[model samples]
Target: MSSGSPLLADLIEALRCLPGVGGKSAQRMAFHLLERERERGLKLADTLHEAMQRIGHCTRCRNFSEEPMCTICSNASRDRHLLCVVESPVDLAAIEQATGYRGQYFVLMGRLSPLDGLGPQELGLDLLSERLGEGEIEEMILATNPTVEGEATAHYLAQLARAAGIKPTRLAHGVPLGGELEYVDRGTLAHAFGSRLSVD
Candidate 1:
Protein backbone atom coordinates (compact mmCIF):
# COMPACT_ATOMS: atom_id res chain seq x y z
CA MET A 1 0.00 0.00 0.00
CA SER A 2 1.38 3.35 -1.05
CA SER A 3 0.73 6.61 0.80
CA GLY A 4 -0.11 9.79 -1.16
CA SER A 5 3.52 10.92 -0.79
CA PRO A 6 6.06 8.95 -2.84
CA LEU A 7 8.89 9.91 -0.46
CA LEU A 8 6.99 8.52 2.53
CA ALA A 9 6.33 5.31 0.65
CA ASP A 10 10.04 5.10 -0.26
CA LEU A 11 11.01 5.65 3.38
CA ILE A 12 8.72 2.86 4.51
CA GLU A 13 10.11 0.55 1.82
CA ALA A 14 13.64 1.43 2.88
CA LEU A 15 12.86 0.68 6.53
CA ARG A 16 11.56 -2.74 5.48
CA CYS A 17 15.13 -3.74 4.64
CA LEU A 18 15.81 -4.27 8.39
CA PRO A 19 15.41 -7.80 9.68
CA GLY A 20 11.94 -8.71 11.08
CA VAL A 21 10.50 -5.38 9.86
CA GLY A 22 7.46 -6.04 7.65
CA GLY A 23 5.38 -3.60 5.60
CA LYS A 24 3.18 -2.38 8.48
CA SER A 25 6.10 -2.13 10.92
CA ALA A 26 8.10 -0.16 8.34
CA GLN A 27 5.16 2.14 7.66
CA ARG A 28 4.72 2.82 11.37
CA MET A 29 8.43 3.53 11.74
CA ALA A 30 8.36 5.84 8.73
CA PHE A 31 5.42 7.80 10.09
CA HIS A 32 6.90 7.94 13.60
CA LEU A 33 10.16 9.29 12.25
CA LEU A 34 8.47 11.81 9.97
CA GLU A 35 5.89 13.03 12.46
CA ARG A 36 7.73 13.02 15.81
CA GLU A 37 11.37 12.06 15.42
CA ARG A 38 12.61 13.86 12.34
CA GLU A 39 15.70 15.30 14.09
CA ARG A 40 16.61 11.93 15.65
CA GLY A 41 15.94 10.24 12.29
CA LEU A 42 18.36 12.61 10.57
CA LYS A 43 20.98 11.95 13.22
CA LEU A 44 20.45 8.20 12.82
CA ALA A 45 20.85 8.52 9.08
CA ASP A 46 24.13 10.38 9.49
CA THR A 47 25.46 7.86 12.02
CA LEU A 48 24.37 4.93 9.84
CA HIS A 49 26.09 6.43 6.81
CA GLU A 50 29.29 7.04 8.76
CA ALA A 51 29.30 3.52 10.21
CA MET A 52 28.65 1.97 6.80
CA GLN A 53 31.51 3.90 5.29
CA ARG A 54 34.02 3.32 8.10
CA ILE A 55 33.34 -0.18 9.41
CA GLY A 56 35.16 -3.03 7.67
CA HIS A 57 35.92 -6.64 8.57
CA CYS A 58 38.95 -7.23 10.74
CA THR A 59 41.72 -8.97 8.80
CA ARG A 60 42.46 -11.33 11.71
CA CYS A 61 39.06 -12.44 13.01
CA ARG A 62 36.64 -11.07 10.36
CA ASN A 63 34.75 -9.03 12.99
CA PHE A 64 33.45 -5.60 12.07
CA SER A 65 35.90 -2.84 12.91
CA GLU A 66 36.89 0.63 11.87
CA GLU A 67 40.45 -0.54 11.23
CA PRO A 68 42.18 -3.64 9.85
CA MET A 69 42.15 -5.27 13.28
CA CYS A 70 39.40 -5.35 15.90
CA THR A 71 40.02 -4.50 19.55
CA ILE A 72 39.63 -8.10 20.65
CA CYS A 73 42.12 -9.37 18.08
CA SER A 74 44.68 -6.72 18.93
CA ASN A 75 44.38 -7.02 22.69
CA ALA A 76 47.64 -8.33 24.18
CA SER A 77 46.12 -9.71 27.39
CA ARG A 78 43.75 -12.16 25.70
CA ASP A 79 44.92 -15.76 25.52
CA ARG A 80 46.21 -16.27 21.98
CA HIS A 81 46.42 -20.07 22.35
CA LEU A 82 42.64 -20.32 22.86
CA LEU A 83 40.52 -19.64 19.80
CA CYS A 84 36.73 -19.58 20.03
CA VAL A 85 34.91 -20.09 16.75
CA VAL A 86 31.44 -18.59 16.40
CA GLU A 87 28.92 -18.41 13.56
CA SER A 88 28.37 -14.67 13.80
CA PRO A 89 29.54 -11.49 15.52
CA VAL A 90 26.37 -11.47 17.61
CA ASP A 91 27.29 -14.88 19.07
CA LEU A 92 30.73 -13.57 19.90
CA ALA A 93 29.19 -10.65 21.77
CA ALA A 94 26.97 -13.00 23.75
CA ILE A 95 29.88 -15.19 24.85
CA GLU A 96 31.92 -12.14 25.78
CA GLN A 97 29.11 -10.79 27.91
CA ALA A 98 28.13 -14.06 29.60
CA THR A 99 31.46 -15.70 30.23
CA GLY A 100 34.88 -14.81 31.57
CA TYR A 101 36.45 -16.13 28.38
CA ARG A 102 39.70 -14.38 27.60
CA GLY A 103 40.52 -15.89 24.25
CA GLN A 104 40.86 -14.92 20.63
CA TYR A 105 37.90 -15.50 18.29
CA PHE A 106 37.30 -16.53 14.71
CA VAL A 107 33.94 -15.48 13.32
CA LEU A 108 32.61 -17.77 10.57
CA MET A 109 30.16 -14.99 9.55
CA GLY A 110 27.75 -17.74 8.45
CA ARG A 111 27.43 -21.50 8.76
CA LEU A 112 27.87 -24.04 5.94
CA SER A 113 24.52 -24.11 4.14
CA PRO A 114 24.98 -25.18 0.54
CA LEU A 115 21.34 -24.44 -0.27
CA ASP A 116 21.91 -20.85 0.84
CA GLY A 117 25.18 -20.69 -1.15
CA LEU A 118 27.27 -20.31 2.05
CA GLY A 119 30.22 -22.69 1.83
CA PRO A 120 33.79 -23.07 3.06
CA GLN A 121 35.02 -20.20 0.92
CA GLU A 122 32.27 -17.83 2.02
CA LEU A 123 32.91 -18.76 5.67
CA GLY A 124 36.65 -18.04 5.26
CA LEU A 125 37.79 -21.56 6.06
CA ASP A 126 41.06 -20.93 4.22
CA LEU A 127 41.91 -18.08 6.53
CA LEU A 128 41.00 -20.18 9.55
CA SER A 129 43.16 -23.02 8.29
CA GLU A 130 46.08 -20.69 7.83
CA ARG A 131 45.61 -19.37 11.35
CA LEU A 132 45.44 -22.90 12.76
CA GLY A 133 48.61 -23.89 10.94
CA GLU A 134 50.49 -21.03 12.56
CA GLY A 135 51.00 -23.19 15.73
CA GLU A 136 49.94 -20.47 18.12
CA ILE A 137 46.56 -21.90 19.06
CA GLU A 138 46.45 -24.86 21.45
CA GLU A 139 42.69 -25.32 21.61
CA MET A 140 39.83 -24.46 19.24
CA ILE A 141 36.45 -23.97 20.93
CA LEU A 142 33.59 -24.87 18.62
CA ALA A 143 30.94 -22.40 19.83
CA THR A 144 28.59 -22.63 16.86
CA ASN A 145 24.86 -22.89 17.59
CA PRO A 146 23.29 -26.29 18.13
CA THR A 147 21.41 -26.27 14.82
CA VAL A 148 21.84 -28.80 11.99
CA GLU A 149 24.02 -26.54 9.86
CA GLY A 150 25.92 -25.44 12.97
CA GLU A 151 26.68 -29.06 13.89
CA ALA A 152 27.99 -29.74 10.39
CA THR A 153 30.15 -26.62 10.53
CA ALA A 154 31.48 -27.56 13.99
CA HIS A 155 32.38 -31.07 12.77
CA TYR A 156 34.22 -29.61 9.80
CA LEU A 157 36.07 -27.19 12.07
CA ALA A 158 36.97 -29.99 14.50
CA GLN A 159 38.54 -31.94 11.65
CA LEU A 160 40.46 -28.88 10.61
CA ALA A 161 41.74 -28.42 14.17
CA ARG A 162 42.74 -32.08 14.39
CA ALA A 163 44.59 -31.82 11.10
CA ALA A 164 46.45 -28.81 12.44
CA GLY A 165 47.33 -30.73 15.69
CA ILE A 166 45.16 -28.41 17.78
CA LYS A 167 42.70 -29.77 20.31
CA PRO A 168 39.06 -29.14 19.35
CA THR A 169 36.37 -28.80 22.02
CA ARG A 170 32.65 -28.22 21.70
CA LEU A 171 30.46 -26.25 24.09
CA ALA A 172 28.35 -28.40 26.40
CA HIS A 173 24.72 -28.60 25.35
CA GLY A 174 22.02 -29.64 27.81
CA VAL A 175 19.06 -28.56 29.92
CA PRO A 176 19.29 -25.13 31.44
CA LEU A 177 20.31 -24.73 35.09
CA GLY A 178 17.41 -24.70 37.64
CA GLY A 179 15.05 -26.29 35.10
CA GLU A 180 13.25 -29.52 35.97
CA LEU A 181 13.56 -32.50 33.63
CA GLU A 182 9.76 -32.75 33.27
CA TYR A 183 9.56 -29.21 31.99
CA VAL A 184 12.47 -29.56 29.57
CA ASP A 185 11.83 -30.55 25.95
CA ARG A 186 12.33 -34.21 24.98
CA GLY A 187 15.30 -33.51 22.72
CA THR A 188 17.14 -31.53 25.38
CA LEU A 189 16.22 -33.98 28.11
CA ALA A 190 17.44 -36.93 26.06
CA HIS A 191 20.67 -35.12 25.24
CA ALA A 192 21.22 -34.30 28.91
CA PHE A 193 20.51 -37.88 29.94
CA GLY A 194 22.85 -39.36 27.36
CA SER A 195 25.64 -36.93 28.23
CA ARG A 196 25.22 -37.07 32.00
CA LEU A 197 28.26 -36.75 34.23
CA SER A 198 28.89 -39.01 37.23
CA VAL A 199 28.80 -37.45 40.69
CA ASP A 200 32.05 -37.66 42.57
Candidate 2:
Protein backbone atom coordinates (compact mmCIF):
# COMPACT_ATOMS: atom_id res chain seq x y z
CA MET A 1 0.00 0.00 0.00
CA SER A 2 3.03 2.28 -0.13
CA SER A 3 3.05 5.24 -2.55
CA GLY A 4 6.12 3.73 -4.26
CA SER A 5 8.69 6.44 -3.99
CA PRO A 6 11.72 5.42 -6.08
CA LEU A 7 14.20 6.11 -3.26
CA LEU A 8 12.10 4.14 -0.74
CA ALA A 9 11.66 1.25 -3.21
CA ASP A 10 15.41 1.06 -3.82
CA LEU A 11 16.11 1.08 -0.10
CA ILE A 12 13.53 -1.65 0.45
CA GLU A 13 15.17 -3.80 -2.21
CA ALA A 14 18.63 -3.30 -0.72
CA LEU A 15 17.46 -4.11 2.83
CA ARG A 16 15.62 -7.22 1.62
CA CYS A 17 18.90 -8.71 0.50
CA LEU A 18 20.03 -8.95 4.15
CA PRO A 19 19.69 -12.41 5.61
CA GLY A 20 16.53 -13.39 7.54
CA VAL A 21 14.75 -10.17 6.57
CA GLY A 22 11.77 -10.78 4.31
CA GLY A 23 9.81 -8.29 2.18
CA LYS A 24 7.63 -7.06 5.06
CA SER A 25 10.56 -6.64 7.42
CA ALA A 26 12.63 -4.96 4.75
CA GLN A 27 9.83 -2.55 3.91
CA ARG A 28 9.27 -1.81 7.58
CA MET A 29 13.00 -1.14 8.04
CA ALA A 30 13.09 1.09 4.99
CA PHE A 31 10.10 3.07 6.24
CA HIS A 32 11.62 3.33 9.70
CA LEU A 33 14.87 4.66 8.29
CA LEU A 34 13.03 7.08 6.06
CA GLU A 35 11.20 8.42 9.11
CA ARG A 36 14.34 8.71 11.25
CA GLU A 37 16.18 12.00 11.78
CA ARG A 38 18.31 12.61 8.69
CA GLU A 39 21.50 13.04 10.69
CA ARG A 40 20.89 9.80 12.62
CA GLY A 41 20.30 7.88 9.38
CA LEU A 42 23.39 9.42 7.82
CA LYS A 43 25.41 8.43 10.87
CA LEU A 44 24.28 4.84 10.47
CA ALA A 45 25.32 4.90 6.81
CA ASP A 46 28.70 6.36 7.78
CA THR A 47 29.19 3.66 10.41
CA LEU A 48 28.48 0.91 7.87
CA HIS A 49 30.84 2.52 5.36
CA GLU A 50 33.59 2.86 7.98
CA ALA A 51 33.26 -0.75 9.14
CA MET A 52 33.29 -2.06 5.54
CA GLN A 53 36.31 0.06 4.72
CA ARG A 54 38.34 -0.80 7.82
CA ILE A 55 37.42 -4.35 8.75
CA GLY A 56 39.44 -7.10 7.07
CA HIS A 57 40.31 -10.69 7.86
CA CYS A 58 42.94 -11.12 10.53
CA THR A 59 46.20 -12.14 8.88
CA ARG A 60 46.80 -15.09 11.19
CA CYS A 61 43.34 -16.53 11.98
CA ARG A 62 41.24 -15.01 9.19
CA ASN A 63 38.74 -13.56 11.67
CA PHE A 64 37.28 -10.09 11.04
CA SER A 65 39.44 -7.36 12.56
CA GLU A 66 40.47 -3.78 12.00
CA GLU A 67 44.22 -4.46 12.26
CA PRO A 68 46.71 -7.05 11.07
CA MET A 69 45.87 -9.27 14.07
CA CYS A 70 42.59 -9.70 15.88
CA THR A 71 42.09 -8.52 19.48
CA ILE A 72 42.17 -12.16 20.64
CA CYS A 73 45.46 -12.74 18.86
CA SER A 74 46.96 -9.59 20.34
CA ASN A 75 45.92 -10.62 23.85
CA ALA A 76 48.86 -12.08 25.77
CA SER A 77 46.67 -13.81 28.33
CA ARG A 78 45.27 -16.26 25.77
CA ASP A 79 46.90 -19.70 25.63
CA ARG A 80 49.36 -19.62 22.72
CA HIS A 81 49.77 -23.40 22.77
CA LEU A 82 46.04 -24.14 22.45
CA LEU A 83 44.22 -23.08 19.31
CA CYS A 84 40.51 -23.47 18.54
CA VAL A 85 39.69 -23.97 14.87
CA VAL A 86 36.25 -22.80 13.73
CA GLU A 87 34.40 -22.76 10.41
CA SER A 88 33.91 -19.00 10.37
CA PRO A 89 34.38 -15.76 12.28
CA VAL A 90 30.84 -16.13 13.60
CA ASP A 91 31.70 -19.53 15.04
CA LEU A 92 34.70 -18.04 16.80
CA ALA A 93 32.53 -15.27 18.21
CA ALA A 94 29.98 -17.85 19.41
CA ILE A 95 32.60 -19.83 21.30
CA GLU A 96 33.99 -16.65 22.80
CA GLN A 97 30.53 -15.74 24.09
CA ALA A 98 30.61 -18.74 26.45
CA THR A 99 33.38 -16.90 28.37
CA GLY A 100 35.27 -19.99 29.53
CA TYR A 101 37.90 -20.42 26.84
CA ARG A 102 41.36 -18.92 27.27
CA GLY A 103 42.79 -20.11 23.97
CA GLN A 104 43.41 -18.56 20.57
CA TYR A 105 41.43 -19.23 17.36
CA PHE A 106 41.92 -20.00 13.69
CA VAL A 107 38.94 -19.29 11.43
CA LEU A 108 38.45 -21.38 8.28
CA MET A 109 35.81 -18.99 6.87
CA GLY A 110 34.05 -22.03 5.34
CA ARG A 111 33.72 -25.81 5.31
CA LEU A 112 34.79 -28.43 2.75
CA SER A 113 32.01 -28.87 0.20
CA PRO A 114 33.06 -30.89 -2.81
CA LEU A 115 29.65 -30.60 -4.49
CA ASP A 116 30.05 -26.85 -4.07
CA GLY A 117 33.67 -27.02 -5.34
CA LEU A 118 35.16 -25.90 -2.00
CA GLY A 119 38.43 -27.47 -0.83
CA PRO A 120 41.34 -27.04 1.60
CA GLN A 121 42.97 -24.09 -0.10
CA GLU A 122 39.62 -22.38 -0.53
CA LEU A 123 39.14 -22.53 3.25
CA GLY A 124 42.68 -21.40 4.03
CA LEU A 125 43.91 -24.85 5.05
CA ASP A 126 47.32 -23.93 3.68
CA LEU A 127 47.52 -21.01 6.09
CA LEU A 128 46.51 -23.38 8.88
CA SER A 129 49.26 -25.79 7.90
CA GLU A 130 51.74 -22.97 8.04
CA ARG A 131 50.49 -21.97 11.49
CA LEU A 132 50.79 -25.57 12.71
CA GLY A 133 54.29 -25.88 11.24
CA GLU A 134 55.42 -22.98 13.36
CA GLY A 135 55.64 -25.41 16.36
CA GLU A 136 53.82 -23.04 18.72
CA ILE A 137 50.50 -24.82 18.52
CA GLU A 138 50.29 -28.00 20.61
CA GLU A 139 46.55 -28.59 20.45
CA MET A 140 43.74 -27.70 18.02
CA ILE A 141 40.05 -27.96 18.86
CA LEU A 142 37.75 -28.21 15.84
CA ALA A 143 34.58 -26.19 16.41
CA THR A 144 32.98 -26.62 12.99
CA ASN A 145 29.24 -27.19 12.72
CA PRO A 146 27.88 -30.77 12.95
CA THR A 147 26.80 -30.92 9.31
CA VAL A 148 28.33 -33.28 6.73
CA GLU A 149 30.62 -30.63 5.33
CA GLY A 150 31.61 -29.53 8.84
CA GLU A 151 32.37 -33.11 9.86
CA ALA A 152 34.41 -33.61 6.73
CA THR A 153 36.32 -30.41 7.36
CA ALA A 154 37.06 -31.46 10.97
CA HIS A 155 38.34 -34.88 9.86
CA TYR A 156 40.42 -33.26 7.14
CA LEU A 157 42.00 -30.97 9.71
CA ALA A 158 42.56 -33.96 12.02
CA GLN A 159 44.61 -35.69 9.33
CA LEU A 160 46.64 -32.54 8.83
CA ALA A 161 47.14 -32.18 12.58
CA ARG A 162 48.39 -35.74 12.89
CA ALA A 163 50.81 -35.20 10.03
CA ALA A 164 52.13 -32.17 11.84
CA GLY A 165 52.30 -33.90 15.26
CA ILE A 166 49.63 -31.72 16.89
CA LYS A 167 46.81 -33.04 19.03
CA PRO A 168 43.48 -32.53 17.31
CA THR A 169 40.11 -32.64 19.05
CA ARG A 170 36.46 -32.05 18.14
CA LEU A 171 33.79 -30.28 20.16
CA ALA A 172 31.93 -32.74 22.37
CA HIS A 173 28.19 -33.27 23.00
CA GLY A 174 25.44 -30.58 23.17
CA VAL A 175 25.98 -29.43 19.59
CA PRO A 176 23.21 -31.07 17.55
CA LEU A 177 23.55 -32.41 14.02
CA GLY A 178 23.37 -29.72 11.30
CA GLY A 179 23.14 -27.10 14.07
CA GLU A 180 25.46 -24.13 13.99
CA LEU A 181 27.48 -23.19 17.06
CA GLU A 182 26.13 -19.65 16.87
CA TYR A 183 22.63 -20.90 17.66
CA VAL A 184 23.64 -23.08 20.63
CA ASP A 185 23.21 -21.93 24.23
CA ARG A 186 26.12 -20.64 26.28
CA GLY A 187 26.01 -23.43 28.88
CA THR A 188 25.97 -26.10 26.19
CA LEU A 189 28.81 -24.45 24.35
CA ALA A 190 30.84 -24.24 27.57
CA HIS A 191 30.19 -27.92 28.29
CA ALA A 192 31.17 -28.86 24.73
CA PHE A 193 34.44 -27.02 25.10
CA GLY A 194 35.07 -28.67 28.46
CA SER A 195 34.41 -32.16 27.10
CA ARG A 196 36.21 -31.98 23.74
CA LEU A 197 37.12 -35.43 22.39
CA SER A 198 40.43 -36.27 20.78
CA VAL A 199 40.10 -36.99 17.04
CA ASP A 200 43.17 -39.15 16.64
Candidate 3:
Protein backbone atom coordinates (compact mmCIF):
# COMPACT_ATOMS: atom_id res chain seq x y z
CA MET A 1 0.00 0.00 0.00
CA SER A 2 2.94 2.30 0.62
CA SER A 3 3.87 2.05 -3.05
CA GLY A 4 0.27 2.43 -4.28
CA SER A 5 -0.79 5.49 -6.29
CA PRO A 6 -2.02 8.38 -4.10
CA LEU A 7 -5.51 8.47 -5.76
CA LEU A 8 -5.93 4.69 -5.34
CA ALA A 9 -4.81 4.92 -1.72
CA ASP A 10 -7.35 7.67 -1.14
CA LEU A 11 -10.14 5.53 -2.61
CA ILE A 12 -9.19 2.58 -0.40
CA GLU A 13 -9.10 4.79 2.69
CA ALA A 14 -12.48 6.25 1.81
CA LEU A 15 -13.98 2.78 1.46
CA ARG A 16 -12.76 1.94 4.96
CA CYS A 17 -15.41 4.31 6.31
CA LEU A 18 -17.96 1.57 5.59
CA PRO A 19 -18.86 -0.69 8.49
CA GLY A 20 -17.02 -4.04 8.90
CA VAL A 21 -14.71 -3.15 5.99
CA GLY A 22 -11.02 -3.26 6.84
CA GLY A 23 -7.92 -2.21 4.92
CA LYS A 24 -7.75 -5.24 2.65
CA SER A 25 -11.48 -5.20 1.91
CA ALA A 26 -11.38 -1.50 1.18
CA GLN A 27 -8.44 -1.98 -1.18
CA ARG A 28 -10.24 -4.77 -3.01
CA MET A 29 -13.39 -2.67 -3.32
CA ALA A 30 -11.41 0.28 -4.61
CA PHE A 31 -9.65 -1.90 -7.18
CA HIS A 32 -12.92 -3.48 -8.32
CA LEU A 33 -14.61 -0.10 -8.73
CA LEU A 34 -11.68 1.23 -10.72
CA GLU A 35 -10.97 -1.80 -12.92
CA ARG A 36 -14.11 -3.84 -13.57
CA GLU A 37 -17.14 -1.90 -12.28
CA ARG A 38 -16.51 1.77 -12.86
CA GLU A 39 -19.97 2.36 -14.36
CA ARG A 40 -21.75 0.51 -11.55
CA GLY A 41 -19.61 2.27 -8.97
CA LEU A 42 -20.60 5.64 -10.37
CA LYS A 43 -24.23 4.63 -10.32
CA LEU A 44 -23.87 3.46 -6.72
CA ALA A 45 -22.26 6.74 -5.75
CA ASP A 46 -25.05 8.75 -7.38
CA THR A 47 -27.77 6.62 -5.75
CA LEU A 48 -26.17 7.02 -2.33
CA HIS A 49 -25.97 10.78 -2.77
CA GLU A 50 -29.61 11.01 -3.86
CA ALA A 51 -30.79 8.86 -0.96
CA MET A 52 -28.82 10.87 1.55
CA GLN A 53 -30.23 14.10 0.21
CA ARG A 54 -33.86 12.95 0.06
CA ILE A 55 -34.38 10.59 2.97
CA GLY A 56 -35.24 12.11 6.33
CA HIS A 57 -36.62 10.89 9.65
CA CYS A 58 -40.30 10.07 9.72
CA THR A 59 -42.13 12.54 11.92
CA ARG A 60 -44.37 9.94 13.56
CA CYS A 61 -41.96 7.02 14.17
CA ARG A 62 -38.42 8.38 13.66
CA ASN A 63 -37.75 5.88 10.85
CA PHE A 64 -36.20 6.98 7.56
CA SER A 65 -38.79 8.11 5.04
CA GLU A 66 -39.16 10.52 2.17
CA GLU A 67 -42.41 11.83 3.65
CA PRO A 68 -43.28 13.13 7.10
CA MET A 69 -44.79 9.81 8.16
CA CYS A 70 -43.44 6.39 7.27
CA THR A 71 -45.62 4.07 5.18
CA ILE A 72 -46.33 1.91 8.23
CA CYS A 73 -47.41 4.92 10.28
CA SER A 74 -49.72 6.24 7.57
CA ASN A 75 -51.33 2.94 6.67
CA ALA A 76 -54.83 2.91 8.08
CA SER A 77 -55.04 -0.90 7.98
CA ARG A 78 -52.33 -1.27 10.59
CA ASP A 79 -53.23 -1.46 14.30
CA ARG A 80 -52.62 2.04 15.59
CA HIS A 81 -53.34 0.90 19.13
CA LEU A 82 -50.23 -1.24 19.36
CA LEU A 83 -46.90 0.51 19.13
CA CYS A 84 -43.77 -1.61 18.69
CA VAL A 85 -40.74 0.37 19.85
CA VAL A 86 -37.47 -0.59 18.21
CA GLU A 87 -33.87 0.59 18.42
CA SER A 88 -33.54 1.36 14.69
CA PRO A 89 -35.28 1.25 11.32
CA VAL A 90 -33.26 -1.88 10.47
CA ASP A 91 -34.68 -3.62 13.55
CA LEU A 92 -38.20 -2.58 12.54
CA ALA A 93 -37.63 -3.97 9.05
CA ALA A 94 -36.45 -7.29 10.50
CA ILE A 95 -39.52 -7.66 12.71
CA GLU A 96 -41.85 -6.68 9.86
CA GLN A 97 -40.25 -9.23 7.57
CA ALA A 98 -40.22 -12.03 10.17
CA THR A 99 -43.52 -11.72 12.00
CA GLY A 100 -47.19 -11.00 11.41
CA TYR A 101 -47.01 -7.79 13.40
CA ARG A 102 -49.71 -5.57 11.93
CA GLY A 103 -49.17 -2.89 14.54
CA GLN A 104 -47.38 0.43 14.11
CA TYR A 105 -43.79 1.17 15.17
CA PHE A 106 -41.54 3.84 16.71
CA VAL A 107 -37.85 3.69 15.91
CA LEU A 108 -35.64 5.00 18.71
CA MET A 109 -32.75 5.26 16.21
CA GLY A 110 -30.49 4.08 19.07
CA ARG A 111 -30.46 2.65 22.57
CA LEU A 112 -29.63 4.69 25.66
CA SER A 113 -25.88 5.18 26.16
CA PRO A 114 -25.43 8.01 28.63
CA LEU A 115 -21.65 7.78 28.55
CA ASP A 116 -21.81 8.24 24.79
CA GLY A 117 -24.24 11.17 25.13
CA LEU A 118 -27.22 9.05 24.01
CA GLY A 119 -30.18 9.55 26.35
CA PRO A 120 -33.97 9.88 26.40
CA GLN A 121 -33.76 13.09 24.37
CA GLU A 122 -31.56 11.49 21.73
CA LEU A 123 -33.99 8.54 21.45
CA GLY A 124 -37.05 10.84 21.05
CA LEU A 125 -38.59 9.52 24.27
CA ASP A 126 -40.38 12.83 24.76
CA LEU A 127 -42.09 12.50 21.38
CA LEU A 128 -43.01 8.93 22.25
CA SER A 129 -44.56 10.21 25.48
CA GLU A 130 -46.56 12.73 23.54
CA ARG A 131 -47.77 10.03 21.15
CA LEU A 132 -48.74 7.80 24.07
CA GLY A 133 -50.59 10.65 25.78
CA GLU A 134 -52.73 11.08 22.68
CA GLY A 135 -54.69 8.08 24.05
CA GLU A 136 -54.61 6.06 20.83
CA ILE A 137 -52.03 3.40 21.68
CA GLU A 138 -53.15 0.63 24.06
CA GLU A 139 -49.80 -1.20 24.36
CA MET A 140 -46.10 -0.75 23.71
CA ILE A 141 -43.89 -3.63 22.64
CA LEU A 142 -40.26 -3.23 23.72
CA ALA A 143 -38.18 -4.70 20.89
CA THR A 144 -34.86 -3.10 21.57
CA ASN A 145 -31.73 -5.26 21.15
CA PRO A 146 -30.63 -7.72 23.83
CA THR A 147 -27.63 -5.66 25.00
CA VAL A 148 -27.28 -3.94 28.39
CA GLU A 149 -28.12 -0.54 26.99
CA GLY A 150 -31.09 -2.01 25.15
CA GLU A 151 -32.33 -3.56 28.39
CA ALA A 152 -32.08 -0.30 30.26
CA THR A 153 -33.90 1.50 27.44
CA ALA A 154 -36.67 -1.11 27.49
CA HIS A 155 -37.09 -0.75 31.27
CA TYR A 156 -37.27 3.01 30.97
CA LEU A 157 -39.83 2.86 28.14
CA ALA A 158 -41.91 0.33 30.06
CA GLN A 159 -42.20 2.79 32.94
CA LEU A 160 -43.14 5.51 30.48
CA ALA A 161 -45.84 3.28 29.01
CA ARG A 162 -47.27 2.58 32.47
CA ALA A 163 -47.44 6.30 33.15
CA ALA A 164 -49.43 6.73 29.93
CA GLY A 165 -51.80 3.90 30.95
CA ILE A 166 -50.52 1.61 28.23
CA LYS A 167 -49.49 -2.02 28.72
CA PRO A 168 -45.83 -2.83 28.07
CA THR A 169 -44.34 -6.14 26.88
CA ARG A 170 -40.96 -7.42 25.76
CA LEU A 171 -39.71 -9.85 23.16
CA ALA A 172 -38.91 -13.35 24.38
CA HIS A 173 -35.29 -14.26 25.17
CA GLY A 174 -35.14 -16.34 22.02
CA VAL A 175 -33.08 -13.47 20.72
CA PRO A 176 -29.68 -14.26 22.22
CA LEU A 177 -27.77 -11.79 24.38
CA GLY A 178 -25.82 -9.26 22.30
CA GLY A 179 -27.60 -10.41 19.14
CA GLU A 180 -29.12 -7.84 16.81
CA LEU A 181 -32.58 -8.33 15.31
CA GLU A 182 -31.36 -7.60 11.78
CA TYR A 183 -28.98 -10.58 12.03
CA VAL A 184 -31.47 -12.95 13.64
CA ASP A 185 -33.09 -15.64 11.50
CA ARG A 186 -36.66 -14.99 10.40
CA GLY A 187 -37.96 -18.10 12.14
CA THR A 188 -36.20 -17.20 15.38
CA LEU A 189 -37.53 -13.66 15.33
CA ALA A 190 -41.05 -14.91 14.62
CA HIS A 191 -40.80 -17.31 17.55
CA ALA A 192 -39.48 -14.60 19.80
CA PHE A 193 -42.34 -12.25 18.92
CA GLY A 194 -44.89 -15.00 19.37
CA SER A 195 -43.56 -15.88 22.83
CA ARG A 196 -43.12 -12.31 24.04
CA LEU A 197 -43.79 -11.72 27.74
CA SER A 198 -45.72 -9.00 29.50
CA VAL A 199 -43.59 -6.47 31.30
CA ASP A 200 -46.44 -5.27 33.55
Best by lDDT: 1
Off by over 4 Å in 1: 1-4
lDDT of 3 by residue, 44-162 (tens): 99998899899999999999998988898899999988999999988998998999999999999999999999999999999999999999999899999988899899999999999
What lDDT would each prediction earn against the true structure? Answer: 0.96, 0.88, 0.92
Count: clashes, candidate 2: 0
- Clashing residue pairs, candidate 2? none
Candidate 3 to truth, TM: 0.79
Candidate 1 residue lDDT tens string, 73-157:
9999999999999999999999999999999999999999999999999999999999999999999999999999999999999
Q: Which model is ahead, 1 or 2, in terms of TM-score?
A: 1
* lDDT minimum window of 10 residues, candidate 2: 1-10
Question: Which regions of candidate 3 deviate over 4 angstroms?
Answer: 2-6, 174-200
Q: lDDT for model 2, on a 0 to 1 scale?
A: 0.88
Which lDDT tens digits does candidate 2 get at residues 29-85?
Answer: 877877876778789889988998999999988999999998999999999999999
By lDDT, the better pick of 1 and 3 is: 1
